[model samples]
Target: MGNRVFVVGVGMTKFEKPGAREWDYPDMAREAGTKALEDAGIDYRQVEQAYVGYVYGESTSGQRAVYELGLTGIPIVNVNNNCSTGSTALYLATQAVKSGQADCTLALGFEKMQAGSLGTIYDDREQPMMRHLLALAELQEFAMPPAPYMFGAAGKEHMERYGTTEEQFAKIGVKNHKHSLNNPYAQFQDEYTLEEILASKRIYGPLTKLQCSPTSDGSGAVIVASEAFVDKHGLADQAVEIVGQAMVTDMESTFADRSAISLVGADMTRVAARKVYEQAGISATDVDVIELHDCFSTNELLTYEALGLCPEGDGGKLVDAGATTYGGQWVVNPSGGLISKGHPLGATGLAQCSELTWQLRGTADARQVSAAATTSGVALQHNIGLGGAVVVTAYRPANR
Candidate 1:
């Protein structure tokens, strides 16, 4: 690392269902970006560069989004890496500061999506997920609405291979929905019993409507600055250091294994998590809070093992023991995760970043993890996209 990078500020808009709020991408960006700048106690002019992320927008949408903040002519790069778009932008911003390219940079992500399941935008050309779909088809029949079928099959594999039950998976939906009850920004704050989760309309194998993330419209922003900038701006007290971060793409094993678990980028998540832990000079046991990509309840269970929170095939046991919830070993998805918090693809990762930042700063309000429970003061984040990209990040107070 060249210069230590710190997240000086973070902000996000309330995640709402698609069309529930009358706002466009620009409006979302303006709200989140302005709040972040204010939180950092800096002006937009102070940002030397920016990386904006959005999935369903025109080519210059990034420039248009940032124009809502200022017209400084700063370099603006638009990013779209499927579901991981938000963190990909964040990864670039952190690299800019870490490599000494710029003292300060901004990472912003927003999305305005249509309600319902996601589908391919262009039918005339090759779909990005065709290869993964083909790989999955080799094991089981392809089902309608690719997202649920893909993750749901992985859940089925877990059930067959490890004796994981449908009730174990339903527990994740229940926990996340209950967790969302405290998060004012979450799209779905209503709590549900495990019976309620299991009884919801089934979308795929062992997966129900309540277990899947809903389409959402929202934006999130994070301001990253160098150590020097933090001291100069008197932000050291609140700065959260980016101690370790790594991004990994699909590995050969992703396809070679022919397992539904690996087919959904579990290997990518494992590799990325290992790299982040190695970089931070810590182990999985050292982490306190986590905000992972739980686009589906099944994905959340798979991630528990992928992130080394438990041994392979023991994720169900971990869930059964309640090791991942509050009053347990680590509080995973304190923000309700994607399943309940909402999944606006472009903004998901930034929302994770914002939540973890607030947790480390002890400012998450009702959703705050108990200070005693977060004794390690280390927060871990995992965000992955299906076309094959995963970003794992570790954060702690700068003074630590």
Candidate 2:
């Protein structure tokens, strides 16, 4: 990497469902892109390259937006990496700056998830392989051929093994929904208790309707510039540097083995976190807030283990103690996460980054964490693969 990359601007559109999948996504994307540019106080023309993140958007979606936004001079690349598509765009944009290919780059995550109901980041080059991989994941998770509920069986087995109560999982639903109540941009907002969550219709095994993230239509964007560029532009005082980032992918699907509560937390997350720790010169204790990938209640339970927030098989303890809550140690999903905030696969990753940046900058008004006494907030984002492709990214405020 060349010196370092800094994020100077961020933008996110309110999650909604009113636009066409392909065309409407671009409109929302342009709105988000303009917001990011304005937030940085830089002209849209300054954006040298654009990397668009979308799990289900059509090909060259980035270019389409650029053309619509009247910025066709630069290269716009489309990225499709399943749920981690947004982060993949961030990673690529960071590289563009770090590699000196561009001083200022645009990293955008925009999608009409409801338009593309079947969630995925498809690449025709290897669609068969990806499909085969996902199908195999479904197969591995179920013994019966072509079972409808691949994740359900694992959820049930996890409850049986860990003695995890339905209430425990429902508490997660309650917390996120409560948090979402304060989020104006969130898609789902209502009050529900553990009993309500349990009483809700079952989507899979132990997973109920309340436990899953809603399909969202939204956009997230950030502008990353090199240290030299920030200094030259007199933007060093306002930029947030990419202190450390670690992204990894697992070949196995999540359903294969539900015995491990930590899942990738122990293997992938630990390794990735350790790498970022070495790079950022910090530990889990130093992190002030974490915006995790909470697509399901059980995922967060396992994350507490994988992220080293608690001992093995004791992730539930962290929740019970309120460690994952806003006022607790290292608040988790202060933005209400995917379940409450809505999970537009493409936009979710950058949305996490945007929320992290705002919290670190202390710009979150009503939902802000007060008295934390930490401007040096450590932000963590988790983006999971369809089966088990998990990518972890961490950040710190550069201006602070």
TM-scores for every candidate against the unseen true structure:
0.99, 0.88
Clashing pairs for model 1 are none
- Residue lDDT tens for model 1, 296-358: 999999999999999999999999999989888989999999999999999999999999999
Off by over 4 Å in 1: 372-376
Error of 2 at 143 (Å): 9.9
Per model, state how many residue pairs clash: 0, 3
Ten residues in sequence with the least summed lDDT for candidate 2:
142-151
Highest-TM-score candidate? 1
Put down candidate 2 lDDT per residue, 1-400, tens digits, no spaces: 4568888999988887535234487688888888888888898788899888886656787788656556547888898877778888998898888888999999998877544325324354664234434544543453321121443444455577677776777788888888888778788778798888899987766678788776778888999998877888888656777888877765343224433332323356666677877888887777887888787887777677777788766776677888888778877888889888988888888888888777777787766765322556677777765434556777777766
Q: Quote the positional error of residue 130 for candidate 2 in Å.
A: 7.8
lDDT scores for all predictions?
0.93, 0.73
C-alpha lDDT of residue 269 in model 2: 64
Candidate 1 achieves a global lDDT of 0.93
Off by over 4 Å in 2: 18-23, 115-151, 251-266, 371-373
